[model samples]
Target: MRTWNDSLKIGIPLLDCQHEQLLDQMDQLLEAMESQKGEQELRAIMGFLKMYINNHFNYEESCMALYKCPVACNNKDAHAKFLITLQDINHKIELKQSLELIVTQVKQELLDWFVNHIKSIDTRLQSYVKKSE
Candidate 1:
């Protein structure tokens, strides 16, 4: 239900773009679920999500490293936690859990986590990078 907006922007163009793409992907996943697509479709979306997360996290971490952001470690830790949570959800899906339940959990957990991460961790990293500049 969440859409990418200016409020989510961290003042970093690449990261912001990646965030938008991520939101778009999440929307697609939700749509697929709503349309009652099979487990294969859901798995495909999950694969894409994993790849996107890896790329985005790497990019963000590199930026943090480049700028010597103090919050880099915390950011990495948050990313790790998210990855673990996502994997657990995927495992549950693999176990033939109800699609509705999986979808709801994904929507709630991911949307909430992403919003908080962007607001807190990413904003701080952006501010630090901008200050360095």
Candidate 2:
């Protein structure tokens, strides 16, 4: 599981803190999934994310727009894709899918996507973040 670190910072404190919280949550979720205590924990984490992620995305998107960042559209697109993935995960849970499948899905869809988004896509915001500061 990936832990939050300074290397992940986008040069914005609020967004960086939100990203840290998300990384921490993802780590907890992954740990729980690995330990076979996933179902309840997954539900809780999903519930939390359902609320938190939207706010985070909105703030990030707004910043992108305000700064006229070149990656604004890509960031919005990625966020939409992530929301769909989250819905798909919830659907699978509702269908009583195997925990193993859910774990694989989360790892592939959520964890990997998030890390890559940060390192690649979101990193494009660094210049803007610096300018804002």
Candidate 3:
């Protein structure tokens, strides 16, 4: 249900685009759940997430490194934590835990984290990049 808004833009085109893609994927997963889709659809979303997140984080980290951003370490640490949380969610799903609960957790946690990251970490990166340019 989380949609990208202009307020979320970090003033970096590439990073903003990547962030939008992630939000789109998250929206798709949320829609699938709302539509009462089966596990297969959820699994598909998760599969896409695993690959997309890895690529996005790597690219972001590279950008941070290129600019020598002070927050690079913290950003990477946050990324690792998110990956772990995602894996734990997957494991819970596999264990046949409450689907609704899991979905709610994903909605709350991921959305919260994404928005906060963009505002706090990515915005700082954007400023650094702009200043460098």
Candidate 4:
């Protein structure tokens, strides 16, 4: 099930809202997979993933730069890599490749990256926002 757990909240309401939305879409995709749904369902997943990442990535990078984060560039690079991998995964799905392995990998990678990135990297950005307020 998709969740907006307290652990995922980054002390920024707007960002947290975005994260909740992204997770919801992800959960929908997972549910579709569990139901043996096919490529049509994956279309929405791909679209949501693309849109969410585009918008959220910008917000994150802007926040990082605005905060003069020491790791802003590194964080941006990591996000870019994630976007690329997400695209590749979608491509593989489109090619009628076995999604089971890809889905499993994506879930683990995304969850780990999301939690760590927000808690460590984003917390630094949040710290700046807090100090400025």
User: Against the true structure, whose TM-score is highest?
Assistant: 3
Estimate, for each residue in 27-107, the C-alpha lDDT of model 1 and write its tens digit: 877887778888898899889999999999999999998998889999999999999988988798779877788778877
**Per-residue alpha-carbon lDDT of model 3 for 1-133, expressed as tens digits?**
5589999998889899999999888788778776778888888998998899899999999999999999999999999998898888778767868777877977877767888888989888987797789
**Candidate 4 clashes between residue pairs 3 or more apart in a chain or in different chains:** none
- Model 1 Cα shift for residue 121 (angstroms): 0.7
Which stretches of candidate 1 lie above 4 Å from their native place?
none
Ranking by lDDT: 1, 3, 2, 4
Pick by lDDT: which candidate is best? 1
Tell me model 1's lDDT, rounded to 2 decimals: 0.86
**Candidate 3: which stretches are off by over 4 Å?**
none
Worst 10 residues of 1 by lDDT: 103-112
lDDT of 4 by residue, 1-133 (tens): 6545788777888888887787777777767766778789888787888988799989878887887878899899889888888787778778877767766856776655666777777766677778878
Backbone Cα, N, C clashes tallied per candidate: 0, 0, 0, 0
- Model 2 misses residue 113 by how many Å? 0.7
**CA RMSD per model (angstroms):** 1.4, 1.7, 1.3, 1.5
Worst 10 residues of 4 by lDDT: 105-114
lDDT of each: 0.86, 0.84, 0.86, 0.77
Q: Write the per-residue lDDT of candidate 2 for residues 57-88, one digit (tens) a residue.
A: 99999989998899999999999999999899
The TM-scores, one per candidate, come to 0.91, 0.90, 0.93, 0.90
Where model 2 places Cα greater than 4 Å from the true spot, the runs are: none
Model 4 alpha-carbon drift over 4 Å, by segment? none
lDDT for 75 (candidate 1): 94
